[model samples]
Target: MPVPIPGNPLGYTLVYAIDSPKGPVLVDAGWNHPDAWAALRGGLLSLGIEVGSVSGVVVTHFHPDHAGLAGQVREASGAWIAMHEADAALVKLMRGFAEEEHHDFQADMLRRAGAPAEEVGAAAGQRPWVPAQPDRELRDGDLVDVPGRTLRAIHTPGHTPGHLCLHLADADRLFTGDHVLPGITPHVGIYPYDRDDVDPLGDFLTSLERVADLGGDRLLTALPAHEWIFPDVAARAAEIRHHHEEKLSTLAGLLADRAEPPTIWETAAMMTWNKPWEDLPPMLRGMAAGEAAAHLRALEARGHIRRVQGVDPVRFQALDS
Candidate 1:
């Protein structure tokens, strides 16, 4: 069922309802607005499932667009919610990140990325990193108790540390949340922490391969959160992986050709974007910098680049150059 996301161009999120012996199980709940709530209720009512008939909820990740109304649903239905433990912790961290220290941390992060004063201010308020408490914290390969369905949680941690994709091998389908989308490549970045420490891009690439391997014979259908259903889960994963690979190569080329070494912020500006670098909003630009830092760290790990640390904003160059 497509539940509307008020004020979003993406229109709505697909909240799949699976028939179980107990009651209906919803894969996701759209935005937690009155309009979105009505949409979900109406959809469920039409399906002969009451708003309170939902027995359980499985969030693919902790993003608000996907899990926004989850709390509301459980409140109404007494439904148990489950998510990977890493994401549960991330949600807590995100919700607590609205304090003065967190704001200062973000500003410092942007400064380290070489962002200007105005951009730093615009990017500082990344509030509402929200989630509800999960009744059960899942691990990789754990079998979810979605009555009558053999749904196994596959920890695909790149999109958001504890992001999960449910593999229903019995039905030959995969419920890929934001981990794998048909029309968009998931964003992976290092931020609010040491870029030298986290390698989100690397983790994302590896997770893609793992999910692709799960596809086995490529006969499975992919049911992504945002987009419509599609077939050939393996091919789609390969396409997304290659998309990131191309980005890695492009960044390596930029590092190789520069007259002077580039800071994370400078390299992000130099890299390609669907929109011109300067034209992107301040928040998105900050996100771009974080992503660039992730790629640089990944390349450093791969021995394709070397870090020139101790610079205010960290700098790097091609190792072979």
Candidate 2:
């Protein structure tokens, strides 16, 4: 089912409905906008299901676009919502934090990522959100209650700390929730909203290996959160893994420059972007920096680069430097 997100790059998110003994179990709830909500309801109705009849919801993560309607659905259908514990903790933290405090936290993060003062001041107001908390906490290897279907949760912690990919044993299908998408690589950047992330890119690479292993020869098609579905998830996994490996190598070369060891900002600017880095909007630029930082952290963790302190903006260099 297609549920639209306002001003989203992708036109809409695909919400998969599984027919179960109790009722239809939904994969993810769409955006919170009125039109988006309407689209979701209409889509469900078209499938001969009512909004109030959804039995369960397995949220892949706590991203606003994915979990926006979760609360509304639960209220309407009394459907039990389940998500990864890590993302659930984040949602709860957001719920507890005051608006001003949350804004300040986001502004501080922008500043840390080398955002200019003006953008930092306007960061929180750009798009504010508070996703509903999950009623159930999912962990790796946990099976979602799909009655006859054996849907196991794979905790993939790169897209988000609690990102999940649901494996359908009976159908040999993998419902990859922004963990793997067709044609493009999923962002493994740090969420600058709050808290420090450690080795996110590393975690992402590991998760790719795990998914590839699971899908080895028996895998069927991959149903991603966006775009079209495709076969050969393992081949796609290898492509993504190689992309990161090449990025690491490229960053290492840049860091190894004798005269100009780069800061995270410099590295991001110098790295090839889908579009010119300078042309991207402030928020996207900050996201780019966070992605660069994730790579830097991954390199540091694996002893490929050394971080230099005492500098105003901080800098990194090849470990041999």
Candidate 3:
């Protein structure tokens, strides 16, 4: 069912529910807003299920849009919430953050990305909301607690470290959260922007192939969190991968043509986006910079580029140049 997210451009999040012996197990709960809560309750009622009677909630990831209402669901129905172990840990980490600390971390990341003073100021002070802790920690291939049905959790960490795509083996349906959306490519970014050790884009690319192989010979009907359901998850994965590959090439070429290496902020502004960088909002600019950082990290790992050390804000140069 579509749970409305008031004021959000994406409109609503599609929260899927599977009937179990205990009650209905939700694939995802919508955003945490009064309007969203009302919509979720109403939507469940329309399906002959009650929000207060939901047996369990299987979160796709820790993103607010997807996992925001999970805690409320448990509060209302005593439902058990499950998430991938990595994301659960992330939530734990976020729980320890003070509002100021969260704001400062983002502000520092923006500064490190070479954001201007005004932009850095604009990006700061937006407090982070920590989602409710998950009651159950799920691992890849773990069977969900849905009696009589075989629902398997596939850990597909890219967009977030603990993202999971649930597989309904009995129904041949794959609930592909944000990992494989139909119209939009999921943003694979390095959070804590200073932590350059992990390669998120690389993990994302590998995850795409991992989920694609789940189809094997038969096509798995994909039910994503946003947009309508579609068939052939593999094709969609390939398309998203190609888009990133093209983006990587564009970034590398941009670096090669530059006389001096550009900071992530500069590189992001120069790279192509749906809208011009000047028009992008502060939040979007951060996302763009993060996307640039992830791609640059991938390129560095592949020997296509090298990071320039001893810089305030990190910069990169194309080795092939």
Candidate 3: RMSD to truth: 1.3
lDDT accuracy of residue 278 in candidate 3: 95
Off by over 4 Å in 3: 99-103
Query: Which stretches in model 2 have alpha-carbon errors above 4 Å?
Result: 99-103, 124-128, 192-197, 258-261
Candidate lDDT scores, in order, read 0.84, 0.85, 0.89
TM-score top scorer: 3
Q: List ranges where model 1 is wrong by over 4 Å.
A: 99-103, 124-126
> Candidate 1: deviation at residue 132, Å?
1.2
Residue 106 in model 3: lDDT: 77
Give all TM-scores, in the order shown. 0.93, 0.94, 0.97
- State the lDDT of candidate 1 residue by residue for 9-33, as single tens digits: 6788999888888888889888889
Instruction: Estimate the TM-score for candidate 1.
Output: 0.93
lDDT tens digits by residue: candidate 2, 135-182: 899999999989988999999999888999999988899999898888
Q: List the residue pairs that clash in candidate 1.
A: none
